[model samples]
Target chain A: MHGLRRVPENLSGRGDKVMEDKYDVVVVGAGPAGSTAAYSAAKNGARVLMVDRRRELGVPVQCGEAIAEDILNELGIKPDRRWAVNRTNAVKIVSPSGIEIRISEKKVTGKVGYVLNRKVFDKFLAVRAVKAGAEAMIGSYVNGLVFKNGRIGGIRGVGLDGKFEVAADVVIAADGVGSRVARWAGLNTALRFDDIETCAQFQMVGVDFESLSMLEFYLGSRISPGGYAWVFPKGDDLANVGLGVLGSRAERRPIEYLRDFVSRMPGLSKGKIVEVNVGGVPVCGPIEETVGDSLMVVGDAARQVNPLTGGGIDSAMRAGTIAGEVAAKAVEEGDTSKERLKEYERRWKEAMGKRLTRYLKAKEILLGLSDGELDKLAEVLRGVKFDRISLTDMLKVLVKANPKLLWKLRGLL
Target chain B: MEVDSSLCLRCGACVSICPVDAIEATDSYVRPNERCTDCGACRKICPVGAIK
Candidate 1:
């Protein structure tokens, strides 16, 4: 029989050097990846510390704020008061020639995604992480990594008052697109300018609109060369109008393109701009390696954004959950080595990786096509009913529209 | 206003979207004036969430 664990006499002692707190895990960047990692880790009975560089967890909102409802349910997170904007039921894709193809709302998983209030939604996720027993830190800028025997130990960051270090068995890198943590840890995540897309968006009010229920997407080189524009309805006569342009074409600039498009639209021209936002989306392939020696990366930091849509939230959450389980297991086994952490890459690749690879390939092929070719393709597609269109059906249409392009797509298709 | 040079793409997105012409593209950055309405247009238009 084991005696009751003796209580240390230093419950309130002055000689005590305040034993440095050590968490099971330390998550950097309190975005979707970090927050999800923290929540999951804490739920597994591991201590977690979540940090964000901003003074506030989420504000000065960014992101399209669109996430699939199926993903939300899978993560066990419900739509709360804070981030709920509206449930999206349908999507309209307008071709360069102004031909529109509407995809109706058919809930395959009995779920429809919501257009969120990002700042609020982000904070809500952070709050959930905290509720799950993770310590939350804001306005904390991570200065560098802590290492032990050539393996990652934890992180060091500066808060409002003083600098401090958090020690943990594992570190989760969720720092967004420009994150350097993984690179610093010797995980290569180099990205090229062409792989990036510079995007701009605005929250506008007082605009007269029809059918507030649908999300409209405009595609064509004329509107946005190597990119497209979107108008996401935010209710109350408000909308988030945005554009994403290839970063290589930095000369045109996203806002300039947005301005030119908005000026031409009578429905949008009347709206008064209440907010402006800008960000860059990585429209390239995923990072080659997502884990190494007690470390894992998720979300935009890992270059996991959709190559075509530039949407990352849902994927990030999924990746984060996977990262959490792997990191926690690594900690429990006392082996945070690269071999053990390789599970993260294996898990994500097996699950979402295949789909992402397919989409990335499609994006590359589509980007190589000429404006005339795209217009012709769009014209052909306008005749087909979207209800009957599957991936193969769409490919058939493309093949019929341009037989010459078929040979080039042999490898990709 | 000071643009953190690290994140500024200097793509002139702000200058292009400025309805009041309060922002201009300088050699290194987008310079804003007292005329800046803080309408948050530049903030929304930035692709990297660079503007506040």
Candidate 2:
């Protein structure tokens, strides 16, 4: 029910038919969040345009690529063989003293998850958005925002053809961790050193796995230093090996730690590295303000990543859906003010805000524990198996065995 | 602040943590702009020791 407002004819000289100068909504970044937002907006009867700086979608994959099946189900999407490369059913957690805790559906609350081929998966989502009547412009870089009467009006950027400006009623920023879009619009999305996780990853072939369907996590100060290392399997002999180091505690670059870890591990040292990815993850939880007049920020741009797990694909998609729906409704009602856009913040908070805050608190406490404490905690639960244990129950068990942890963990209880 | 181009990955890790918006990155290169106050936030967060 929203109508597209046309810009002055002189604003754009080219008048390209495929690339319009105006749209109901313009989404920057064609990843899961942007594509999902475009798709939802278009489905809700809004004319949409999605853009990405990359010439190809998902190239140079930046993620570990593991996502829970429940997320896909909630989005009403079925896993396809083309992008879902492998399925994992369990997680192996390794402590500093070589203690292993295997958690699966039988032992704890775990579910089937997928390891994605992001290069294919990102393009697939973009294609779905296009099919839903959203126009996509790849190989484009958005460097600035267009403001009209002191409010966000549109985006200004360069595409494969040339420089262009597109006017829109609302702009969705899904530009990932280093996003400057929202900041450019006057939102303080800057992160502190202690609030981020510096990370590095290597996709290797001929790797060894303890279990083909299990994900491995190595935790210890010597291993990662206030963070952890992970191995997510892609095939029987292929895996994505990675590590994240807390920015405040990192003594060396994350890549150096990862290389040392791989060299020391017999199972990983034998593999050959095929690809390298280095990036940063914001572990600060969601920003305070994610909505402004005619602007909405979602995904990593809004710091929607899980502080404890460093997982974001699920939250990004969920937040994108809500942002898109809210943007469409605001446009339809002809009120794209900050007051109207506040609905998006309210809805996402109602869904996952409290959980993210709790995780942030847990991450702080866990990161404060020394290697000796972690070892003691792991030793206490060495052989204990639970049919099903809630996070509180697990915390209670640890607190009972090691009363030393009671003061630090009492907040969680 | 200086970016060791050889070690830099153009991943924009430094760009986000720069409080003054002093870093700029493209597909081919990353550089510190005039706004840089030598805070070292970028250097600390660089995954490959690219920033100095």
Candidate 3:
């Protein structure tokens, strides 16, 4: 009710009457990033409007639905039973030769892991944003951006009623991997084939798992070709079976790879597919720039996904909080220029930039490994009890196990 | 560019990777506009092999 109110006909010389609204901040896309940004901005006293193309906040789910509990704690969110379907504390990594390496909580930064019901979790986050004084518009598609003297000023989009415009001091682009908002704002956000991982997933019922509270990852070229397959259990007999293949390495569609993967896995082949989700993940790490004059990009729009795991919810939420806080402060100071907004970029980089870069390098190394080498690596890691292993420690173990890998992995050391 | 609607998932992967901003995605469908350069970027990124 606070946004997109009716306006007089042809107020700006357009033939059709357009509804208009104004806010201190306008967030495109109401996913984790957008909702979190809205919540943060509003909490910091900024008049904010959050919009999403979906009529519902989290319908036709696109994520693997796994999140670390540390992120929730960091965001000060209490885990609700309605959204936290299953709690996992271990991750099982399976090699091509069927060797399994289990990583316990000690190895993970978070004490607990959760496979979320994103439909509920995402909506809950949006509702929280609204409750914190942000306005939300659903079923709205942002088609264009309003620019003033080469600086982003607002957004133009179609809502359920009709064409609408929302002028804002700052616009946060949290529009996911397929985002055009940043590009429209003069940022070259185009992703290369090598930087993207085309993914396919199915929410399945009646699948079998050794541990309902364990997340499974399968690694091998034959399985996913430069990416990996995952099974995140939502319940004892249900799971999200998915796989991602690097676009540059893919010979067939990701769906075909997913089908083949599901068909071959004894535990998954018997399951019934309840939902199909597919999308492209930007595994290129964070882009060169995420902030422009009056514009800030968060979430997948800014390529904030982890290169090695293809996980983004954590990064998105963290960046969203920072962007929201910065946007609000910048607006309060009456300076939403790129220089003022650079604080958001600096803070987020300080938080996760080095880790992302290291992961990207690790991903490149993993892509160069043959299935046999992966098996050997897994063999060396199998049954090893790790109190706490950082990336450097993991690399050291690998180097010790397979001295041949020393030269290839010395860069990481 | 042509989309085989039967296989298209409306996931917008093609829209994100297009350097030309040629793709448009609605809730029900996704299509390539005249700005398309036939670079096959969309086809390569399509998860279901829907683009032609």
Top of the candidates by lDDT:
3
lDDT of candidate 2 over A148-171, digit per residue (tens): 998899999876677889999999
Clashing pairs in 3: none
Q: How many residue pairs clash in each candidate?
A: 20, 0, 0
Candidate 2 falls in which docking quality class?
medium
Interface RMSD value for candidate 3, one decimal?
Answer: 1.0
* Per-model DockQ against the true two-chain complex: 0.09, 0.70, 0.80
TM-score for each predicted model, relative to the true structure: 0.83, 0.93, 0.94
True-structure lDDT of candidate 2: 0.85
Best prediction by TM-score: 3
Between candidates 2 and 3, which one is better according to DockQ? Answer: 3
- TM-score, cand. 3 vs. native: 0.94
Q: Which stretches of candidate 3 lie over 4 Å from their true place?
A: A1-20, A106-110, A388-390
Q: Where does model 1 sit among the CAPRI classes?
A: incorrect
Tens digits of lDDT, candidate 3, A1-413: 33223111211223122333778999998899999999999999898888787776677678899988889999889999899999988788899989998877664364787999999999899878877877777777889999877778899887677788889999999999999999988898899999899999999999998898789999988889989999999987999999999999999888898999999999999999999999899999899799999999999999999999999999999999999999999999999999999999999999999888889989998989899988989988885776542467668888887898888886788
Candidate 1 per-residue lDDT over residues A148-211, each given as its tens digit: 7877888886665467787889899997765657766987665555777777788889876555
Question: What does the lDDT read for residue A49 in candidate 3?
Answer: 80
